[model samples]
Target: MKQLLFVLAFVATGLFASSQGAVKKYRVGIFASLYLDSTFTGSTYKFTNQMPKHILPGLDFVQGALMAVDSVNSNQPLEVMVYDLRSADQSLDKLRSRNTFDSLDLMIGSVSGAEYRTLADLALLKNIPFVSATFPNDGGVTNNPFTIIVNSTLPAHCEAIYNFIMRSNPTANLVYVRRKGTQEDRLASYFAKYNKGSNGSTLLKWKTLNLNDNFTQTDLIPHLDSLKTNVLICGSLDEAFGLNLVNVAQKIYKTYPMELVGMPTWDGMKDLTKPEYKDLSLFYTATFFNTGTVAATNFTKGFTDLTNGRPSDVAYRGYELTRFFIQLLLRYNTQLMQHLNERTYRSFTEFDFRPVLNSTSGKPDYFENKRIYILKRSNNLVSRMN
Candidate 1:
């Protein structure tokens, strides 16, 4: 009878252990500059002093995505810990003092370039995955095996813009107008390469304009009047310069018609809709959500319902990032870490993070949703060109 009791006790203990093991929990760390001052109240502002009250819709979007995933997967309760890194006085020391890094399975944020570098180092040391919802400005977190960029980089954007222009106007002459900064210069070089063999022959021309000193309509007016090209590409994000370019192009369009093309920075700028830019018919490239497709529309509605109708770029990014990660987790199950290292998530982007080495000579790779939208500005209204 004692032997029988011992066997039963062992069986009960094993069942309890199994049940406990099935209820696994995960903690995700969200480090961001969400605590901005109330002085800058707008859709783009990332921070506020109101505790959980005035936090932007982007935060809600991210939190909602995590919550939705957690609701269905009760086995693993995901606990998201947020770090408000918005103050100018904020430092890595404060982040370390919080001891928030101790139990983190993954880290996501739109930290400053410097803070991103620090977080990259910490993530590598801790062996945790890191995702950046915004552009980090420092050419991505290199050497960090666990870091993933949710937003497409500047180079990818440039490539997409180049391809779209080449396809749309095979015979059109292309002229690139750029500033003298590192980012601008890099894009200029990229355009040079693409224009060399982009279409049948080299039909693109390059022109450099000093954005600091000699950046006025007068400087580009002569070129515009003389050029046979009708398409003009601006490689700078300076809103002031963009406005000037648009103004100049509009004036020149009276006699010489031209099309202004820019990168993703052209989106959401209220200044572009002013009367001065009315004649500047602009075309630019943006991500899938910005294009307003059926899938994107449904997702946006779902996101708006969760966040009280406040939306922005970060909100869309958070939704897509969370959805992608959740899909990856469900598909790979326990082998997520392994599969990530092996570059298995090809559907996420055309260029899988793992298989594609970040080099120039490899496949003409681009991020997964390379669907570029040609946005045209007609009568100061922006619409997607079909």
Candidate 2:
């Protein structure tokens, strides 16, 4: 009887090993700017007291992705590997020389500049899905269907802003305020190109107010009309300019019902939530937003429990996108590209992915998320208006 029990246990152990081995395992690569070498030296700490501000975003993003990988309680086998692109001993050629990406099923990057472009190109060459997690620009990687840009481009943001204006308050008095600079002028050009696509001559009429050093309410009141709703578009990305506009608007908007729309960068402006700016109605565009859904709420709790702080937008993107694409990788395997637009995993934000095409060739450039959320702030509280 003892021999029979030992034989049964031996058979059960063999079966468990067989099942574990039979499961298909996928190799996933996550590249972020962790700056590991700079922070650590042979297990010794470099900055003992506090982490540098430059490395915080990358650390937070990687932490979120690690949480996501742990939360994936599926039957499929997943092997995740994280590479620090900003490490002292790291470079694109060094990574490639080691054949680090040879067996990768998918790659995700939280990097920009040359690293981003290299990964995108590598994904194209290898026929693997390389998810550009944070960089807003396309980085000139054209005709690559394997590249998926999670962060919408500047032009997409401009289009979303124009669409919001036309749909929300088309007949309202439109005023575009900007400060003169190279980047600011370029943004103005983007708006002009997108705004011209609408039908009718008088359908979209906007007057530009270029703010200077001597700018004040006396210069702004001329464009605002007290009789109708004044929709002010802050066309520049300057933080000081945005704050000045808020001060001026607060003084004038008590008389006029005004809504101030800002650029995508304004989403990161925590100062807008202060008590002094509470009364002003403000709006801005962002790629990802958590509105306290069950999943999002749980993620926040889990993140806070782990780090004792709330997760930032980049962290949330890392968690959501990692979970999302890994699920797809397990389910669809190598054919994930065919279902790029499918709404399978509903995370914090509903991603609206559309194919971007090359201008001259008219072929598929890459997949991009065109949807931008317009968040509204009033009375010291913020909510998604769209």
Candidate 3:
């Protein structure tokens, strides 16, 4: 009788332990801008366009990924608390005051630069991880070892374009055409730095053209002839100016043929499809997501189904961000939170968040850069370039 009782007690203890080991939980906070007013059918939660309804598709993608994670690993179940900031006008205040953070483990936001700064400050103070889908201003939040930027930065895009130009046309003389704007100035500065090397000596020369003032290609005819350059790279974002440049360039092509290089703003600009741009080929650098690769296509399909066909940029942002976070949770479990401060993590777009520390001070100094994709558009067809 004593041996039978001992066996029963041992089995009960094992069963309890196994059950406890099979359950895991994580609390997450989603803070977004609500710019519109609408309600989900049959749900008490009202949604707005403050964050753009189109972004809902991406959000749905993330939800689907999370569900998949939960099914595969019953131990880790995610509890998400969403906060809308349209009415309050101060999302950070709401986030900080919320009782949810007491149990919250991670935060994801698709706010603007100003809002991102507010959240970054809060995340640093609380030692929590905050991921932003868009580019955050450089000075807004660095040094917060926990802040992660999923989108490629503007400067990184500039560098990628510079590198592509150097590698493809090592000795090609170039003419830089730009409108008088801060963006154009920045690109010019980057190109100057890129051409400082030995082989780049006189390899590139630029002629700045202000569309507002110059207005016509005839204004640039003299410079084009004097420079004797056959390549024109545009660094302006104004659609009107871009179209004007393309039109003028096409007219000139009848006499002086030149290849055109452009910035990522040209990606979906309808001006490129006009008859004036037919003879001109444009190339630019963009993150792989914009080009719609295999992974992007699959994600888009899953995202569309989840959002009931409402197309949104936020939806993709939400979906990919959630997918990546879920993967980290599955791989690292509770340890995933700890790895937030690390240098890098595998993302749909390859990302490395490893901190760069000052050698003597032993403090984080900067973030190591990652990869970017280059795209080329010719005759209305866009494709990855090498």
Candidate 4:
């Protein structure tokens, strides 16, 4: 899903800048995969003036950031510069040669994988605050206090899931339904780690139900408790598995009280709110969700008017990240790290950047957002439970 990202081209715009002032101008760099090179063949447009579906998310992110930039009513000019990692000849050395980091106060990227790693290293070297807007994984980044992961990691999700289960369903029959795979094992271990760390007690001990890749309803029904609520945490990011799990769970829900919590990837299941899943008590964690605030409502309207369609969560995330971090840079200036966990400003999601320690080094490698939203959908209505 994160592929097809190397597409966006660099675009920069002027923000109010001042050489000397209490609120001086700050340069901000936004790196995204726009794939500008592939769009044109020496002058003729390849796609014929139409944006591809694959590139829309990144572009939407840019649009959201632009909207936030426009909304800024301050003297502290944010000289925003956008870079397309998918450029024909773009490289870290090329970017470094430009000596751009010398002027940048903050850097944000909706990038992932190797691109994320390069930028993260640059942030570490320059002591610049790098806001990773969309990537979920840390890419093995360690000993880097400059990196801030806005999208919480998988371990963070597992911890949040465990906390939700123990707090809300202390006595519920907890069953971890996972397909046999390395990823599944890793996910299970995360929950296990969290369970072990919680006061050295496995209060939320779960009955593991390992199934084949092509698991059927018969494989799950035997483990579910009909007499009590069965809280099943699906330990897989596979959408196919999640769909099947939901289908089987729905059938079982008719006779048993069941709640199925899915991984973060399940957020893209648009059909969850359909008639079939209307009464399904589905749970999932996400970094952000539309809270229907006046600002959010206006943003939705504006986004629809601009794109002629509804905006995705990435769009909201882009706006929130840009607006939030810019305000932080403006307010704290060089001392933004001192108040990294402050919850004073919010756009859609609440970010609490807690330092993530590297296991081998026993020191903070990076900061990640630990705050999670347990969104529950029941009776055709969705609400954030925590």
TM-score per model over all chains: 0.69, 0.90, 0.74, 0.91
Residues 262-323, model 4: lDDT tens digits: 99987878777678877788999998878899989999998787667777888898888888
Error of 3 at 143 (Å): 1.6
Query: What TM-score does structure 2 among the candidates reach?
Result: 0.90
Q: Candidate 1 clash total?
A: 4
What TM-score does prediction 4 earn? 0.91
Predicted structure with the largest lDDT when compared to the true one: 2
Candidate 3 segments whose C-alpha is farther than 4 A from its true place: 1-24, 35-74, 87-90, 197-214, 225-229, 290-295, 310-313, 333-348, 352-369
What ordering of candidates by lDDT runs from best to worst? 2, 4, 3, 1
Better of 3 and 4 by TM-score: 4
Two-way lDDT contest, 3 vs 4, winner: 4
- lDDT at residue 1 of model 3 (Cα atoms): 18
For 1-386, candidate 1 gives per-residue lDDT tens digits of 12222322232122111123545546556565544433234333322333344445435544434433433343444455545465343446775776768766666666657777778778778877666556524345444556665455666678778777877765554556776777677777777676676455775444555555346666666665444546778888776666667767777776666788887787766778777777667887655435566646766676566544555666556555554554455455444445543333222222234322447555312122234455777786678764
Error of 2 at 383 (Å): 1.1
Instruction: Give, for candidate 1, the lowest lDDT window spanning 10 residues.
Output: 10-19
Badly placed stretches (over 4 Å) of model 1 are 1-22, 36-76, 86-102, 136-140, 180-183, 196-203, 206-229, 275-279, 291-309, 333-374, 379-386
Q: Per-residue lDDT of 1-386 in model 3, one digit per residue for the tens?
A: 12222322232122111124436666566666432223323223343324344534334433443333333344545565555554352356654675445565666776666777776676676666667665534444556665666665666667778778778764554667777778778767877776676865655545655557346766767666533346677777666676677777877776665667777677657767776566576787655444466756676675456444543444555655665665575567546655643433333465545554556667653343346667767776776775
